[model samples]
Target: MCESPVRHAHSLLFVPATRPERFVKALASGADCIIVDLEDAVAEGSKDSAREQLAQHLPQLTPGQLTRTVVRINAVGTRWHEADLALLRNWTMHGATVMLPKCEDAATLRGVAQKLGDGARIVALIESLAGLDAADALAREPHVVRLAFGHLDFQLDVGIHATADEPELAFARSALVAASRRARLPAPVDGVTTDTGSAERLAVDARRARAFGFGGKLCIHPNQVAGVNEAFGHTEAERAWARRVLEEAARHGGEAFSLDGRMIDLPVIRAAEAILGG
Candidate 1:
């Protein structure tokens, strides 16, 4: 698989494709990836105009900004899906990223791969029971770079009335993470925190995602970027510990050892490497 810029993104911010003026600003919002949303963000009647807006303004972005940007097309079975793919033809050839919403099967992703060809990178959004059940298959798709949780729609689809903390979705979150690991993909991205105005809520959500082994959180607002970034990032103390662990491992010739009364084995060494690697 080709390297994906969003593979380790900590914050994926959404900007409505209809609002082209905000594109540059969203890219500058310190988000690791900016998702240009053409799915839920655009009304049914405005889909075509939204594509037109993107066609006109997307080219204005610098190559670097475009590299960090992802275009979220309508779901596979939606009326606008084919048109969205058509609009993305040139962009995909130039190494653009695409996020497929409500991805429930490998065949759908295969179809997209055929359309986007080799240059495009795909993020599969799991939002329904069908999607959750097929998470393993979806993750194993060669073109899929990562899996993302769409918790809001997922809850509705499964008739789950989850609370703010959303403990009910734990199983689904773990399933995605496991599937990604099995497929050797980066840790999956977590769903968005709908309460955009609450910094505390965003922080809690981002941190909770990190605890669940998610690499990133989706954000509807630019304000949520810093919180997500901080949550996914390692602290100075964590870096120091990771460095010490590696030094000790080297001294011990990569064998198991004890550090601060805790066993520093292969698993611990790997964890330390991941922390320092990021």
Candidate 2:
């Protein structure tokens, strides 16, 4: 699989491609990645303009900013897909990742990979039933590095109206996470929180997504970055416990030991290491 920028990103912020002025602001928002959106966020008539605007602004991004920037282009079958791909293939250093929305097959991704070459990396946004069916193949694709859940569009397509708690999407969430792990990909990214003004709801959603084994989440606004980052970050208590677990395991070397009345072993130490590393 190709390298993934999202593999290390805990908070992904979206900025409208038409809004060039906001590009620098989004990059400075403390978000791990900034997605310059030319899909849902841009009006149909303005797509060409937004595309041009993005090309102009992208080359201006500093090297440090390039690694944190992503471009969310239109779906594969759309009118803008070819043009977007052309720009992406040519502007290799503009961004580290590309978000391919509504991916339902590997063929499209294969074509994208071929067009973008090895320099530009891609992430699949699985948002439809076809996507759910093809996720395994998508995750295993050579150029496809990570999977991201697009819950709002997904629910609308499936005709499901879920409550604020999100219990209805549980099975789907678990399936994607399992698929990513089975394919040895980074934990999938959860969808965005629509409640931009409600930090309470956003934090709740972020925490829920993190518990569901998601490595990161999409942020529609700058303010959501802090909460999403915090939700995914290891707490002081978790870090302290992980340190202690490692210390005890080192004393025993390769053998199993008991700590705080609980068993400490290779599997236990590995889990602690994951927390510390994250």
Candidate 3:
């Protein structure tokens, strides 16, 4: 199987599949993963053209770039969905990942996975109540490399008009995070900020996602990449704290100890190890 590009991604930037010219630029933007989106970003009338352009351009990428590239096909049951998978069958030979939008059930994901076959990985985008309800099963799917919240569509699906901070989406966010953890997947990726005009908004949203245990954020613009990366990455202070915890834990011979006036137990030790590993 192909290695997953998203396991440690702090930022996943989306580029419209029709705009092949921007694909290389997006990869160079320092985003951890670049998603070439055919769903939502590509209009219905332009879907075929977008897929053709993507087919022509994908083989041009180096294997390394292909590993970091994610092609977001239309949701299952859509007219374009089969064509999208058909195109990928030939083009993803270098192990590029796929993002399945509006993913809601195991059978659908499993069918897609079987179609893509070995070495194919999927990032499941949970966008509706059905998807949220199926998050646990979706995360447990063997080929699902990551789970991402599509909070914008989810809000529309759930009838919650949320502000930028999205307090209304707290339950969904927590559920996704918990599901991913229980499935032993990497922390789930939070949805896009949507307000690309405000760097502060992006930073705040990214940080908020991190606070909720998300390992990454979806970026709609190249400019948002840096902010998302910074927000999800561990700070020097955090690294220092992790280092101290490890050193003290070693001194205590892996026994529970006190650090910074707080009890350091197995859970705390594991958290520190994760920070330092990142």
Q: What is the Cα-based TM-score of model 3? A: 0.96
In order, the Cα lDDT scores of the candidates are 0.91, 0.88, 0.91
> RMSD in angstroms, candidate 1?
1.2
Q: Compose the digit string of candidate 1's lDDT tens values, residues 185-251.
A: 9999999988889999998888888888899999999888999999999999999999999999999
**Candidate 3 clashing pairs, residues 3+ apart or interchain:** none
Task: Please rank every candidate by TM-score, starting with the best.
Answer: 1, 2, 3
Poorly placed runs, candidate 2 (over 4 Å)? 1-4, 93-95
The per-residue C-alpha lDDT of model 2 at residue 271 equals: 92
Please provide the root mean square deviation of candidate 3 (C-alpha atoms, Å). Answer: 1.4
- Compared with the true structure, what per-residue lDDT tens digits does model 3 show for residues 77-99? 89999999988875556778899
Better of 2 and 3 by lDDT: 3
Kindly report which residue stretches of model 1 are placed more than 4 angstroms away from their true locations once superposed. none
Give me the displacement of residue 220 in model 1, in angstroms: 0.6
